[model samples]
Target: MKIVVSGQMLKYQVRNSSTSRSSPSSYGTASPSSSSSNGSQHDVTLLTTSRSNSLVSLNSLDSSGPEGDWGVLKVYTSDIRQCTDYKTIRVSTKTTARNVIEMVLTKFKLTCRDPNLFELWMELTTKAEGKPVKTILRLENDAKPLELQRCHPAGMSRFLLHMNATGTLVRVYDHNICAASNYKSLMLSSLTNCEEAIDLILAQNRKSREESANYGLFLTTPEAEAQIPPEVSIVSVYVLSQPQHKIVIRPLDSL
Candidate 1:
């Protein structure tokens, strides 16, 4: 009925108090101590988002409970304080990235000074080269189920959950972040063709193509035009990816 998520107090109110035991969450749907009046429950379907920068852990929830979206997720933390759960988790495919983090807080039975200021980053990479491609999961869709918004790579069931910096609105990162709130950058190899480039960009910017009617990947610089023959090869084409209304430029200095 009523779901409330904030920077602190992780609580989820999907089960009816009558049918379920009283569980505690700092990122709560209802007040942690409050329950249904006539013994009713809320139906909440979790959704997906991208991991931010830092990481969380696994031992944050009840792993022995009834099976839901039972899968493995890695929480990469930089420090002891960042280590919220075990390095890995047994999660459900039905759950979202936001729900996973909240579940972590609930699993740890801890509270944060600012919890809503975090995000989930789905790191897309290859098994061969370990190429880094990141995507920002929408934080607002905590209530939506992942069935419709699945970002997990095929055959690669596991996902990553990263945290933002504390006491700051800015997210600090040392590497190239391919995904975020809006537009993100991704690298295309010289051998990648136009079709392959489109596929690569779309894979990282799922939210982008969904929102814009005029989305495309092309060369924006005259320098590129001069070097790339009119032959139209992926090696010469740089991507100007737009998610929603934001423009993401790749080949940084090229354009």
Candidate 2:
């Protein structure tokens, strides 16, 4: 049957055959204490059969909030073929996004394991009672609990390197080539002349090998080269060896 909840414009449609037997207390009274003061006890029940489906829907609404300024969004169960089938109702209020997200996570028995994916968006609205409504947080289908592992300093650096290596490389003309005029000029000139300047330098140091060694020289593509800023494109090389001393060497052309 179609159920239109007033005060909040919430609506739901539940199948009549799915109603189950439920206790009067499970129907959800405004004040349980007051109801019990009359020497009445209520029992919790589920509405899965036709007889109690209406009560179940009403209880669901009651559990959301009292009937007044703001009420819980109605749940549509008529289209649901199975008893366990339920749809999420979007809640919009003035509550903080963080709090709303936390509440939703708690309701779903979920924990924030991935801060990156735990993003929350909220909209603010004034309630009829002149009070701020609670924030409505939405969860994307991809959102799930993520466990983040703490990384040590060394591990963090390695992770950063991996991220950089795998990330898309954007070639900024000014930042990559214009600033490093001297280096670009040298590399370009070498390319034009078919001169293996870099390779020759490696050969002079007896570092040349058919198999790429850890210290072997390699060619950087123009696209890769473009990522180097012009200011850093100068043909200057640095060597670090034993004794913790560094030696600065310039290209042969520089001499």
Candidate 3:
């Protein structure tokens, strides 16, 4: 059996165990598509990469007609410390900043309780006092991404997908021992502390606060792992978060 799952940034190919191993298939230089065939088990899991930037025509890149060809937009997250690379997306002259933000969230498979909690910003870098200074310009919801990119030079400016300071979207793992990808997204206010975040997750699951005391929110990353203190706000932890960061619920006794 063969199955194909497609997303904005990835295309996954799944095959049954009977098939012979094959060389990976590739697409283009700037944007490459790859395929993997595994034949050891009944099921195969396809992995996603951060390098799937599709190609577009150079002339069509700046077209702004009502029926213009597809254009490309480079998007990156506000979490610069961890997410150092930009993601490429296909956009048209009609695509707005809000629409690009939604596309990015979907590409990353993140669900936010409030989509409005996110915004797009234009980051401009200039030299002042013999030093490089960075300025961020917030884009309106209706602002066009393709047109905006056309206005600025490639190296001097960039588009950033940022979470509003008002609140942060958090992913919470369920209270299970297994390492499962199924999780819930919660909109946490900037002032919400670790303890409050736990309560919110429990409430969403219809669990009681009494059980919350027995649980703790732990953050794990490639470099290090630690349990978040009850008094620390979610925004604080979020600032130091990485792309692969995870906040999981573990029994207090296990910690």
Residue-wise C-alpha lDDT for candidate 3, range 18-81, written one tens digit per residue: 2222111211112234434344322222322221122123223555466665779888753422
- List TM-scores for all candidates, in order: 0.29, 0.16, 0.40
State candidate 1's TM-score.
0.29
Lowest lDDT block of 10, candidate 3: 21-30
- The number of residue pairs in model 1 that clash at the backbone is 30
How far out, in Å, is residue 164 in model 1?
2.5
Off by over 4 Å in 1: 1-69, 79-86, 127-140, 143-158, 166-255
Prediction RMSDs, each to the true structure? 19.1, 25.0, 18.1
Index of the highest-TM-score prediction: 3
Winning model by lDDT? 3
Q: Write the per-residue lDDT of candidate 1 for residues 128-221, one digit (tens) a residue.
A: 1222222223333342223322444563323334443332221111122244534434333334344433433544444342422233343333
lDDT of each: 0.36, 0.24, 0.59
lDDT of 2 by residue, 43-148 (tens): 1111211212332233223222332223132221222122323223344322223434444444444331111223332111222233222211132222211100
Q: Provide the global lDDT of candidate 2 against the true structure.
A: 0.24
Candidates, ranked, lDDT: 3, 1, 2
